[model samples]
Target: MAINRILIANRGEIALRIHRAAHEMGIETVAVHSTADADAMHVRLADHAVCIGPPAAAESYLNHAAIISAAEVAGCDAIHPGYGFLSENARFAEKVEAHDIAWIGPKPEHIVTMGDKVQAKKTAGELGLPLVPGSDGAVSDPEEGRKIASEIGYPVIIKAASGGGGRGMKVCESEDKIESLMSQAGSEAKAAFGDATVYIEKYLGNPRHIEFQVFGDGNGNAIHLGERDCSLQRRHQKVLEEAPSPVISDEERERMGEVCAQAMRDMGYRGAGTIEFLWEDGEFYFIEMNTRLQVEHPVTEAITGVDLVREQIRIADGKPLSVAQKDLEFRGHAIECRINAEDPFTFAPSPGKVTYYHPAGGMHVRVDSGLYAGYSIPPYYDSMIAKLIVYGRDREGCIMRLRRALEEMVVEGVKTNIPLHRELLHQKDVLHGDYSIKWLEEWLESRED
Candidate 1:
């Protein structure tokens, strides 16, 4: 099915990203938006724009019927849910397919399988991926959990089976604390994800968050782009990302890249996906997989020179991957700082008018944003307003370029985390790329004391 026109079923920089790719591929785009986003950059730039509903996300962005209706009315041949809202919704993917419209994402079954943490871990292990040692599946029995904790050694983490974002996670260092922590984790999981099921895994004291970018044609063929180090996070939310991790060697990358690609091929996966791992002591442990394009994809793009969005559209059109494993090459180092509309230090959301906006500009600096001087950022969505990405020949050069870029960036009216990113670049640990997943939170804590 050739995708002549695509309905972009998302908002913000990602939607604009999709629109640019579709246009580059000679495919027209229809931008769907809430009333609040009618004046958005993507909406204004798209070939066609449709107002789905009101400002509230539930009444608009998450409204499946309204989106499908808009797609049909716009005569769109495909729907591209760009990394949020309904992007990973298996039911929504099925609904689009039922309507005879191409779904520019992973297959619905793959989404379903990977959406659940326990099932994803099971499948990853079956596909020959190394997993953190612990319980096989959801463990409800307190005594069973105790036994597993004792066997796996102490300091095991309890996590929700149905969701992530650190909501339903607890760490127990001793055997006596397993039952209480399990109950607490289960309660939190039930409240956050509507599922009380929780699983157990051996706790890694300090690990770097490493994820590989992979693409599949849904025909038992796949390729991995490389790995991104996302260890700089706050509350499990990524703050900055970089490609060709400062630590991973070329030999390790090749070894792990093949392992990841083979897993995708074994599953008959499709579209863009990320396989996340916790790296410690020179070994990688599988965590979970995101069956959709990630927020930190730009860094990978900068290093690999691959237009992921364009590849997604091509794969949806039943085309084979443009670049093969042998042809793929990692060129340089790239870093992306997620600039959010918030208090840089306190991390509080700040949504309002953009009094002034001057994004960083240079040869290797790319700013993905939808803000303008007079634009009003509505308070109804995610706080992230921009992504500042920079590339150079090496890690040191990348950081130097990124520092210069950050110095030039100016976003007024609404507060942003620009200062946080600037501070991070100055840290010795960050400069040496010797930080763990707990680095940011601890750094922030030290700032207060």
Candidate 2:
């Protein structure tokens, strides 16, 4: 069951992150990259490199057959689909398993259950997990959507059954906007998931983005790895995240954690997963379950010292968890800021050659960067260039490290969110850890100063 040789089914920082961890454990890593990334840092850092296909995702990252063949040829025992592309693709997970290769993720069934929002909520309810009152199935009729909304009460959210990146969601304030919003939501969902089916759910008022990290050994053992605060977001995408949510009390944390762990067990989930929730008025409502290692796992690693991907590989290989829930300890706070290659003000991708790249480094300052000096920032995939993770004794101390990191970070010839992060740290509410989901957008607009 030892994953001595692994094929990283991804690129960029995540690939390099997995590569470093594997090397530390004396594991050999084979990095798979697109044509554009043949000379990328991940390729150079891996023990071996393979070019899957062209630059586009469909031909490269999402091509399951190609990836499996590459792994087989390389004599790899496992494949780690870091974050995006086929990470959450249930079909891809199944294909990997068919080849007798360890799929470093939850079971394919778990992915399908969570991929569809309506089915996920129903499953949660069946497992005695908290759920915001909503429809049991997709509403094909606008009238049906409104009727369900009336039962649940307004500010209802129309969501795509298979949506991501906050793309196919519409908030309806009243019955007047219900029809138009449903049409828009359905259209967006159809274009995105290839399934036009949409669902209705009650929207919580000013809720915080809270999620529990859990690990299942494909057996009866499932343990919660503490919670993370991801309330600082933009357009439903997280910008900043911290471990040990600042708002939740110890009692509340235990309750939420227990429920999430039990819920995952009820679904017969296997491997590493995240159960996201909307926490408001001290009540938790199931948001969705992420079926792979999350983009924010470094924060959890900083606090718990647990290598999540490593655990995932073992779990998939039918091995038991190394540590028990009671044996683990979260002794500190960690914060992560996503640095995207974009115009600070316009938020548009600014892809080009990196004139200079200086990553921040110091005590408790860990940076997972995908770019190096002169690395080309292609527009093919996400613009996220680096993740700056800072850890400290407390939240305030972590914030201080983030400030210093931002000040020291220097990426020339490419606009970044560094300047915006500087202004964000200075904001009174942000510094006090009392910001909402719209904190960044609203703050940006108010800078009419």
Candidate 3:
């Protein structure tokens, strides 16, 4: 596989992440930057770098034309959209493929199928995979949503057919709420997705967020790397992520992974992807699929010792999975805390220059950051500055290590969610791994009370 040079179509930590991996794999890397990121850490470290556009992402990272042009100008053979921006865009994937440049991710069809929530669910259901009872496709009217909700039982979730990260979701408990919820959800989806199509599903109350990591080749074989527990979240945005959910039984873990791999195979899934689920009342429901590397992929890598980026390249080159299910072994525990540049209490964005910087370091501690001393946190991008990943023999040990790492971290100029993470780690419920998706929000509300 001549995966010699790669152009990273992203910014921040993910760009730095792929750069580090490619460096170790003997692959040259070019970092694409915006005007605000000329002196950014990723740009400074790459073998070659170029400014793709202005500060705003819509004209920069999301601008597929500029990224492909950058790759061509730099003579890069492949484009790796690390995570956000055009990472999961089917049109972008097709555009890169049209240039005869390798897209270091899943196929465009996989991206399209998985990117649409209702279509993904229908496909999964066809494969006999367990899915949450919901509308088969996008619903045009509130009456259709009401019919589906009635059939699926009450307390259903109204979500945008083409949405994610909780941007266009509303939970309606009664038929009365469905009218208002449907109108609101449709409006939000129209604004967010440019498609007013909405869908309904029975909402699982107090469910745990778990997802399986699956990788595949274009030839159709794939295997799972196990599961990650992302139950600790706020506004459906993951706050902390850990591998091998502490609450899941071994049997349940195997069951989920096996079915997820099968589902991917049936869908002709290739490259890195994630199958998200909500487990409650001893049942697992395949919710939606992400046809790209996840933001929380590092925790899985820490436990499996697999460089997913390298695997993505090998698969894209038409090589089958080298590791079989029988050969894979997961050891230890890993946890990731997103160190965002924001207020710990208010949870608002805090964008400014870093006056001072001191990142944590110790055995089994990995800090993936794109910020440095005097680097400004531009208001145009995501507020996350670093991902503090820690691995240990077990979850308990990992917790202690995280506490130590949090104590050692010092971002002097800007406030961060470090205090919130500190308090969350010490909570008995979170410590015991008994929290749910709503735990963080409820915990904060109770703290206020």
Q: Give the lowest summed-lDDT range of ten residues in model 2.
A: 435-444
lDDT of 2: 0.87
Cα error, residue 19 of model 2, in Å, equals 0.9
Worst 10-residue lDDT window for candidate 1 reads 79-88
Q: Candidate 3 at 360: error in angstroms? A: 0.9
Taking the tens digit of each residue's C-alpha lDDT, what string does model 3 give over 119-215? 8888888876788888888877878878888899999999898877787789999987888898899899989889877888888989999899998
lDDT of 1 at 58: 93
Candidate 1 displacement at residue 74 in angstroms: 0.6
Tens digits of per-residue lDDT, candidate 1, 1-449, equal 78999999999999999999999989999999999998899999999999999999999999999999999999999999998799999999999999999999999999999999999999999999999998999999999999999999989999999988899999999988999999999999999999999999999999999999999999999999999999999999999999989999999999999999999999999999999999999999999899899999999999899999999999999999999999999999999999999999999999999999999999899999988999999999999999999999999999999999999999999999999999999999999999999999999999999
What residue pairs clash in candidate 3, if any at all? none
After superposition on all CA atoms, what RMSD does each candidate show versus the true structure?
Answer: 0.7, 1.4, 1.3
What TM-score would candidate 2 get against the native? 0.97
Please list the C-alpha lDDT of all candidates, in the order they appear: 0.95, 0.87, 0.88
Per-residue accuracy of model 2 over 285-371 as CA lDDT, tens digit each: 888888888999999999999998777767766788988888888878999999999987678898889999999999999999878
Please count the clashing residue pairs in each candidate, in the order shown. 0, 0, 0
Give the candidate order by descending lDDT: 1, 3, 2
Among these predictions, the greatest TM-score belongs to: 1
